[model samples]
Target: MQPHEKVKQYLDTICEQIRYKRIHNELREELENHITDQKQAYIAQGMDEETGTFKAVEQMGDPVMVGTQLDRTHKPKPEWSMIVLTLLLLLTGTFIRLYTAPRETNGLELFYRQLLFTVVGIGLMTLCYKVDFTILGEYSSILFFALAAIIVLLMLVINPVDGRFIYASYPLLLFPALFAGVVYSMSNRGYSGVILCGIYFTIPLILSLLIPNITITLFLTLSYLVILTIAIQKKRFKVNQHHALLLVYVPFIISFVVAMTNNNLIYRLKIVFTPSLAPMGVGYMGNITRGIMKGARLIGQGALPENLQGLTVEQVLPLINSDFLLTYITHRFGWIAFLIVVALLELFIIRAFVLCARQKSVLALLVSTAVTLTFAYQTLGFVVTNCGFYLFAPLSLPLISQSSHYLLVNMSLIGILLSVYRTGHMVHDKRFPEKPDRRPFLTIEDGRIIIDLHLD
Candidate 1:
């Protein structure tokens, strides 16, 4: 074929490929069927198959050019407006709690702290967005090392003699330090950074429970799991080792063996099923479960004056506002409000998963998986720790967490997600110019494909 005819044939081949591949399966099938019919028509018009195919190719134009066009149409618009709405809801709720609740506490102090946390989180997110995430992979070891250092420092606080008061809180400071360390370590080990991060949070979860502060542990775990799941589903991790059963089974075996050998371990394990077994230790969960059950009995009646008599929810569970804020919300706002909060959280999880599945971006998929897993895991943990009257504890929900640490953690995640949505390349594709110049096309390198176009 002449150069012009060659170009036409090339363009047609490209267009056909794009038509069959990128489109919905049904649509692609239909388009292929139509192309077959067109080929037959050309043959009937006294054209040979080669000439007919060439005609089909000529009519189709540049595939890259068409793909680019299709991409423009398909790109998911950033949900800036919904993001703003979520932020507003969070801020409004914070404000209500700060100034206008049935009673108010250090409104100014709470506002300033929360505002500072949000600002810092946003700044970090901005930095991450500007830098390529792939670069972070190079520094995963160093990052993990730093996190390990933090965990060691936290471990020091775990000793009461160190005057660290780790026990006073659920080794509160150690939770973040340990989680970040584990995640970093996993990331360096060529695991999915996000999933590793989620797994790492389990350290804090276990410690929090040991401190008998199931609320905070559950919340932190949830946040971490959601983030990690997003990473896994997106294939952010280097390996796809399906080792969930092994991971869980090994831990269970170790715990059971240790519990049989150690009285303390046995005692703690017993408390898992029967909180009454370890009154002081299990009381945290029991009290939360009982309080919510009591409130459930009242339903729309709201917190009774008798129930409100100088009794702080914090007295029932330390850091109740942040970790066990749901109790307060349900108590004052009623069961309907509780249901709404749960529903909204479910919606966010579902949306993240759906968007991840639909998006062509691998990174976005990873991020979505991270978020979904984190939320689902945490939520389940929270319910387990709180649900049955026999088992209960205060745990904060995502986005609605009132604790300064939990709030900071949640905001940091949101900021990262916002950054990803704003700056990510959703899918990898290349588009060539529709009109070809007289210059001869040269060899294309990896990730590069060129199509020469001709009007005739």
Candidate 2:
């Protein structure tokens, strides 16, 4: 081997054994530094430069062995627990749509359609798993603004099927995720970044209000607050933590209080907590849900409300297959089934929290936290509506929903969360720039080199 080519040759050989190509340059840089340091140490001890280089290379062990060990250590890990929980949740929802659904209803048709959504959801999740999640941080600016603009265009300009812009809610659910990236972009900018984020945060809330989507508004608010609180607690912001948090939360408190007092929001809350206030109309669903729940048994089935007067409990719920799934399950298979579904969802959420804490990068942690909390929001909403708090209403919870839009959006978010679990440790926002990766897949043909440029 040529004198200067030895180190290059050794590194290339070691790298060849590694499977994760995105990390190759970083690993090569670290290994090169170590080898260079060892070589200089030998030279300082009076060895010739050539001998020093050779000794350093020899000391590092066999290239293939070193590479194999590193590849094992650095390989992407699939969160099997997470994956299994997801599949179980999907199955649980499917079973409810198929088996627990009323015999008189189109249960088999609902099952078939759910099966299709589940299949598509899994595909989106898998595609996201293969993605580089950290890029969400790098392009936070354009994404946040552009998505905001798209919402306006769609809701105001496009004004699709309904004038109410109900379709905006699906895309609106994604705002918090993109806002996570926005927070990352501003982490180093102190209070100004917090202010900027607060400004951008209103876009979704406002758009949701335009759609008059209170559920989504609450969803966006809860998600924004969680993201903001976590960022402050982590000391991602350069400003004083106390002041930064105050700047972020005082407005939230004041706004919440004002909203409560300024309109019937407070009265509606009262009726939700005390359903008798509007038993005939506003609290209609709440009263029915309460009566049925009170009469539920541990197993078998629950008694229907006296006021059912001829219609099934499922007929009363706004969207039994999607929103009031747990309520329906309780009425069909009893509280045991309800408890089982609830426990499964709770476990999956707890596992996601553990995954979020395990992340080594800020972008991954923030985005993952956002996704996890969004899941929590939807779940809590469903539970509240099921428990007779009809003022807030229920939002869709992934595979458990009949709405195709909910299935796709929720699955896409899950995909991003799963992506964080998969390649999160492998990507750093700064290193993996927003620009397209030019790194080519290199292979040696017989006596020739072929470069396969993969467009991300």
Query: What's the TM for model 2?
Result: 0.85
Residues 1-456, candidate 2: write the lDDT tens digits. 233689899989989999888778788888888888999999999999999999999999999999999999778878789889988888887767776544426656766776887789788878777776766787888988888888787776656565468676678888888999999887756566777899989888888888778898988988888899888887776656777787788999998888878557777878788887788878877887887787788998778877675777766765667667677778877889888888899999999999999888888999999999888888888887887888865668656756667777788888889878887887664542233224424456898986443433
Question: So what's the TM-score on candidate 1?
Answer: 0.54
The all-Cα superposition gives candidate 1 an RMSD in Å to the true structure of: 14.2
Best by TM-score: 2
Residues 104-190 of candidate 1 have per-residue lDDT tens digits of 355456656766766675565456444433222334445444644554466556565444334344225323323422342343233
Candidates in order have lDDT scores of 0.49, 0.80
lDDT score for candidate 2 against the true structure: 0.80
- Please report the candidate that would top lDDT against the real structure: 2
lDDT at position 211, candidate 1: 51
Candidates in order, TM-scores: namely 0.54, 0.85
Query: In model 2, how large is the Cα lDDT of residue 273?
Result: 85
What lDDT is obtained when candidate 1 is compared to the true structure? Answer: 0.49
Candidate 2 residue spans exceeding 4 A from truth: 1-9, 46-55, 100-111, 149-163, 309-311, 425-456
Weakest lDDT window of 10 consecutive positions for candidate 1 = 428-437
List clashing residue pairs in candidate 2. Answer: none
